[model samples]
Structure formats: C-alpha cells, structure tokens
Target: MSRPPRILDGGTGTGLQEAGIAIAEPWLTSAALRDEAGVAALLGVHTGFLRSGSDVLTANTFRTNTRALARMGVAEADRPGYVRRAVDCAVAARAAAGTPHALVAASVAPVEDCYTPSLTPDDDALRREHRWMAGVLADSETDLVLVETQCTRREAVIAVEAAVERGLTAWVSFVVTGAAQLPDGDSLREAARACVEAGAAAVSANCFPHAAVPRALDQLGGLGAAVGVYPNLEDRAALDEWEHSAHSLPPALTPEAFAGLARRWSAEYELAFVGGCCGTGPAHIGALAGLPVGAAS
Candidate 1:
C-alpha cells in the first residue's frame, strides 16, 4: 500500500507578510532576524503551520546566505549569526507548537534570483557559496537542507552536492517555466536526474501555478527518488505583479479548492509530500492534512 503524503508547510515569506512583517529585498524574510518583533512573527508563522498539521517546517534562511546578506549591507562577520538565528527560530517554533517530532528544513535558495537563470554565478562561486550555506545549516543542526526554487540545473546539482557533502539530507526543488522545462529551457527530467545523482534525497517542482501541477507531475512522477510539489495559488500575471509590488495576489483558489487539486496530485501520483507555496496559508495546509489518500478518478 502507498504511504500517505506528508504535508510540508505553506509559504514562509508570504506568511510573514500576512503577519504584518514587511518582506522586501535586499533582505526579504531574512530581515526578520534583525528584530525581536519580526522573530516573534516568524515563530508564530511556523507554529501556525505546525498546528495545521504540517510535517516539515522550513526555516526562514532563504536569504541568509553570505552573498545575499552582503547585498543587504550586512557585514560578512555577522552573516553566519543570521543563519543560526533563522534555524533557532524554527527549532523554537517547533517547540512552541509542541511538535518535537516535526522536521526543520533549512531553505537554500539560488545564489541569485530564482527566476533569472541567466544571472547564475560561475561554477566556482556557486560551489563555494553553497558549501558555506550548507555548512552553516549543518552546524545549526537543521533536520535537512531544502535547496529550493533553483532555476538552473548546474546550480541545483551543486547546491545538492554541497548539502550532501556536509552529511545532511537534501531535497532539491526547481522553478519550472513549463511542464517539463526549467526556466533556462533545460529538461526537468535531466535536472531532476542530475540532483538525484548528486545525492538529493527527494526532488520537487515548486513556485509554479496550481493549474500546472498535473503537467508538473507528469515530469516528476516515477523518478526513483521521492517526488513532491508545492505550487503557488496564483497565475503567471499575478506572480509577476507580486514580484514588483508590496502586496501579494489574492489566492485564486479557496482552501477547499486548493486542497482538491492537492488531493488529486497526491492520490494520482502517490507524492511523497504535498504543500503550498505563494498565496497560501495555514488554512490551505490544514485542508491538505485532512485529505484522505486514495486513487483519483
């Protein structure tokens, strides 16, 4: 019998924004590390997701890497402290929610923007920076490293390798432009295969539209390693708008509607896990947790 799908928590950055935290660059959600109020809001976000029945709570380390921090004018000496704080907040949130058994996955975003693969750094820089990020996560004792929203196959493979080299479990996820393609037009199959070979414990498609999950699964399903998806509940236009605006697009699907799509994906693909991305919240996750596993018609 197939195992039930594990529920990963919904969007962290968006959750922070909804909690009245301003989430703009060059710091993004990582700015939360700078103030007690922001940290408390982050803890509340994680605790809300856990209370909604998520099995994995991703730490808000998505922009705490040295390169990103440097752009934000954070001194190099203080960067690792930010990473540790991100991890500590997640661990503390898990404790606050009374769920010691739940796992904490550290966010490992691409060194550059997730949507612009052309901006990816050279191999040497990619390897060096990812190694530093993974080492810090390992040092902070994260349960796993989630190398997510990777747009280029090369960076994804290197990030996964760095995490695995540190003896940490790695799950690599891509930002796809089409059903079977990464943003740079590389085959999703090829990228997924490369990361898996590089020692990623799982592979996934993330930050795509909810309407695209069926086609995304067509590319991800049947890979020997565990496969999953966490799609945003917004269309292409709205996502693009949100990239330049302070406000996020309202979710196109209600909690029940979003859960319906997740139910189909889980039942049809036997996904290892299912969750939400942008434009999703604890209610969306709670709906996923309530789904019964079975084959979809």
Candidate 2:
C-alpha cells in the first residue's frame, strides 16, 4: 500500500527563536527586512524542519501584509521589499536544507485579523493586499500558496480569487469556533462547498483545538479536492484569552502527545496533509512522520 500523506510543520517565528534568533517582536514579518541576520535565523528554522523530515516549509510571511506592517511603523514604500524578503527567506531555507525536493509554501494569512471577523476589511483593501501577496508568491518559486486561518467566508473567497487571478493553486484553511464549527458558526459541510466553489485546490481547518479537528474533517467530508488538517494543541481557554488580548506569546503543546492525536485522526481520514499550528513545533511534526494514514483501530 502507498505511504500516507505527509505532515507539514507549523509556525516558524518562535521556532526561529528556539533555533536561535534575536526577535524583538515576532509578530511582524517585516522584522526580517530590518535585520538580515534575523531573517537568516528564521530561514534556518525552516531548514531545520526540512532536515527534520517535514515535507512542507511555509514561508514566514504570515502577517506581513501592508496593513499589519503599518501597525508596526513600516512605510508603504517598504511593503514590497518586505514581501520579497519573506519569499527569499524561504528560498534560502530550502537551499540550505540540501533536499532534492520540498514543497515551499507561501502562507497568506486572514485579510482581517483572525478571531475578529467583524474587523473584516472592505473588498478594495482585501483585494489589494491579497493580490499583492499572491503576486509576490507567484513570482517566486513557491509550489503552493496556502491562505490560512480565515475567519469568515468573504475573506476566504476573496483569497481564492486572488490566487486564481495570479494562476496559482490555492489552499483555503479556516480557523473554526471551539464548538467544532467555522468562525461564522456555519457547518464545515457548507464551508467546504463554498471553498470548492471559490476555486480552492484544497480545504482545511487550522489553528483549532485538537479535539475539534476530527469533527471538522467529518463535517467537510467529500469535497473533491484534497482534505488537509493542521490543528493546534493549546488549551482552548488560553487561546481564547490570547486572541482577546492580541498577545504574541504562543501556547505550548508536547509533541509526543499531539502526535498521538494526529495519528488517530490521520488514520481515520487518510488526510492529504497534517500539521500543527501556533504552539506546534518540529518535535510535534517529527512525531507525525511514518504514522499510518488510513483507518486506524
């Protein structure tokens, strides 16, 4: 029988620090542009994951959009360079891995800050940011553009449109409510339908509780495209508080424990891809390697 689909690793920011980088504010991807050494440090973490047997390496451009940068005092003129640096960092990481092949993904975050769908920006703003990010990813050698943590239907569809316009394959992964539903409280069945209709090459639920993941997958069953999953292992209450406070310190999850959960879910769904979010790191992903992918006891 064929081997199971691989597990993708999670957030690179903290992993970069653990891999040894002096990051003052990890939230801004533009920090890489300001300090080449810092950028290199982050890229090194990507290499570490690749070396650790991860099949995918997501570029560290999550939250590098102009809107988020402006909040960090970055000027409009520097946005393009910021975006470019994000891609270059990933490229450098891939090269350092010495691997013959790996899927380098450009991570496109929610147009509006996640967990605050009411803050969803206007279409003009969303389109401009999405198009700019997608265009940059398109120009680079990225294998895929993964738009993640979408909190609303509108933002997810717009991201798909941006990717399609740029002739890139898009993956839309949403952040769902703790109740095992999409942010809008819609069923995943409905969410999957909408994502496929909007041109997503894959559909997933990311940055959610581990317990909720299998339910989310069940709700999304039967979408024609590949079904992926990357659940977070943090305490649900801690995540809610962090979202409310806009804090940067991520919660933690033991790799061994999360791996068991991932293995069980992966077996049941034969998931196309799986990984951790937020608190997940290399250890978590490493534990996922070689796990059975379909119909576990």
- How accurate locally, in lDDT, is each candidate? 0.85, 0.74
Candidate 2: minimum summed lDDT over ten consecutive residues — where? 239-248
Give the per-residue Cα lDDT of candidate 1 at 290.
81
Compute the lDDT of residue 67 as modeled in candidate 2. 76
Tens digit of per-residue lDDT, candidate 1, span 159-239: 999999999999989988645478888889889999999999899999876777788788876667899999877544634
Give candidate 1's whole-model lDDT.
Answer: 0.85
**TM-score per candidate, chains pooled:** 0.94, 0.88
The parts of candidate 1 lying over 4 Å away from their true place are 235-242, 291-297
**CA RMSD of all predictions:** 3.7, 4.3
Number of the top-ranking candidate, with TM-score as the measure: 1
Compose the digit string of candidate 2's lDDT tens values, residues 41-143.
7776777677666787888778777677777787888876777787787778778878657787888888557777788988888988888888777888788
The segments of candidate 2 whose C-alpha lies over 4 angstroms from its true place after superposition are: 1-3, 17-30, 235-253, 290-297
Model 2 TM-score, 2 decimals: 0.88
